[model samples]
Target: MTKPIEVRNPRTGKFDYVIIPQSPKLLSQQCHRLRRGQIQWQELGIDGRIEALQQWKQALLSERDQLTEALINDTGRLSTSLLEIDSFFSTLDRWCHLAPQLLQDTAKNTSVPFIALQQTAVPYPLVGVISPWNFPLLLSTIDAIPALLAGCAVIVKPSELTPRFVAPLMTALNTIPHLREVLSFVEGAGQTGANLIECVDLICFTGSVETGRQVAVTAANNFIPAFLELGGKDPAIVLESADIDLATSAILWGSVVNTGQSCLSIERIYVAESIFADFYHQLVAKAHKLQLAYPALENGEIGPIISEKQAAIIRDHLQDAIAKGAVIHCGGKVEELSGGWWCRPTVITEVDHSMKVMTEETFGPIMPVMPFSTVEEAVDLANDSIYGLSAAVFAESAELALEVASQLDAGAISINDAGLTAIMHEGEKNAFKFSGLGGSRMGADGIKRFLRKKAYLIKTNASKDPWWFNEGESSKDI
Candidate 1:
């Protein structure tokens, strides 16, 4: 007998529901059904698929309020949860408009002679998405929209911590007649995700670096592709000529928003040595001014970390930094907030690369600051990590920022701003180095990742090509 997956409120620490785990046998059966549905679903053609996706998006929009509420309860970040809803709608709109064109057949030129060829985009029959608890609804649903628009079935296995929001969203999606079996959700822990990966044609996972490696290996064993968006120790570089106030605010929010759980969150901050003191002072002051409150209050900018386990990790990193001579300029204690996993918005100075807070992903309300003497030094410091998902460069001019950004080892870099905008933009979400592999979240590339290309050749007349004849004709040139 499979154990029950308990759904708990991260903020309240109380049980919301108990979900009976789906056995591997049952999940495998579900995969077979979804694969069968995909055959007919793809045959419905692009127009039919687009109409169905549009209707599903409309259904999700109608339930925005209830979904937002559920997400807040699960994640405990109010403003970010609402912003996630807006972002979801935007993604849905973009995919609906762009997917059909992206997935259309392309006319290919024959390089050698008078041969007609066509390249067709064929989507995988089944895509398995293993979404993380952070930004659960958006991550789980956004990828499905494009896969469905490209005429593929999607099965989402969301993190157990996020079932509260995903369950309701799945119910709304099921209301669409054309998408009844085209999309499905299975709730469980790590083993279930492993089982799902084995059955799908492709896998897209978003989570920690350690888990991402395991997913990659599993996908490799099956000879299937896996898109992994792993953890990031993102750095923020504040140049000497930057607007100190803008730089400070951007870095502060980038580091603390979502209570600092974002993979793109600014973990290590490098300011030009000339402006280090001023930037550090302003950043700490602003961090102290942030309002920390419950979602019901609607006044909080910083909320609790997701769970006690995550809180423990944050605490360990903060302690490690403090022990290594890092100074806590402001806020560095686990909050005593009732029924919620809370951590204070913390800013630390005198940080070095030796500390875990500066080197590893500190996914909490903690910011570590360092100083660099030159642009090359800043680039070196930013790139000195095992992960390179995103980075930020703040300068007086876009030209200057771009010059430095061009040298950074990150997949996406923001100029004079934070990393949030980079991820929201249509063509920018990707990871470099150990951060990920083989896919993006937007643009033509996003839809194409779910598709395989097939080439067709046509002969205009009853003429046998020289290359197609016997080896005796190989000596003849065309």
Candidate 2:
């Protein structure tokens, strides 16, 4: 028997939960069973699959309170935990509505008069998902739901850092026998995640670039596809003509929401030189109003740094920025309050890419603002990163905002707003650069990625093709 893994509570900073990873032999057996069950799952057809999913959704709804409480304890946040649950529900409904239309087979006439073309897709039998800790429940299921809709059996292994939610989630899954046969959640650390890649037909991972690189290599060695959603140092550009109030408000939320523990959060800010002073002043004022949800979860906008390792990274970035002569407008340090790590929406200025806070993925509520003399300079500064997940642009009008947004190197730019991709799933986008890999995990492609396309060419007539050799011709004849 493998020893159980101890889990840390983000709020109280105690090792309060434990999870035992499935033994390798047991994991292999589970994979074999799930693969065998996928045959029946696919045979159920789209309508049947949708029915089974909706049933599971209802089961999940019944366990909502328990799941919510578990997530709050898992992440040390209140409001975002509730939002995560709602997002999960909406994701189920959206995929159920979209899958049938997206997965329908197509038939059409070929260029050759006597031939017809029929196109269909087959789902890979088993899909493995390795999710991160920040938004434990939401990220874990983001790819799984669509894969299930596409008729793929899915196994998800959420991060060990936040495994408390798995118990309640499993309880919900147990109530739906049909879905239970094809879908499951395992609790484990990196080794288990690595083992999962070997057991599945495809893998989807959401985490740091370092780990994502390892997942990709393992998937390649195993001869399977790996869809990776990695880290980012996402940027936001504010124009001279932009509304200082609106821009600061939008950027503040984009930068510090969930205490900035998101890949799409605005870590770097570039403002037009003409309005740089006003922009920073208003941003500092808005950022100062935020509070850490420490003593009570309802006390403020910012939550405790969910991962202890992440808190250290935030601290290092702050120290590096200060040493390099960056000015902290407010909330500069990562503080420990009753053993929980917290940062209250830090806003910094006079920053550049020379500091780690500006160039690297801090993954905290640290916003470092810089000034740009021209549009060219702002665009250049924003594009000067190895990461390009998403970004934001603020201008006087939609047209102006879009103009700047068009030049960003990232996928999914928010015009006149920020982090719209977090709430809106209808628009399809790819994670550019080190942000991610494989097909878009939004819009129609989310489900389509699980399917492999096959084409059927049909001959309408029995006659042999004109290019074929004459039936009775000699081999040497020209």
lDDT of each: 0.85, 0.93
Cα RMSD to the true fold for all candidates: 2.3, 0.9
User: Any runs in candidate 2 off by more than 4 Å, and if so which?
Assistant: none
TM-score for each model: 0.96, 0.99
Pairs in clash, predicted candidate 2: none
Give candidate 1's TM-score: 0.96
Candidate 2 residues 82-126, lDDT tens each?
999999999999999988999999999999999999999999999
Best-matching candidate per lDDT:
2
Per-residue lDDT of 352-439 in model 1, one digit per residue for the tens? Answer: 9999998888798788889999889999999999998999999999999999999988888889999755356565466889999887
Q: What is the Cα-based lDDT of residue 434 in candidate 1?
A: 91
Where in model 1 is the C-alpha error above 4 Å?
Answer: 421-423, 468-478
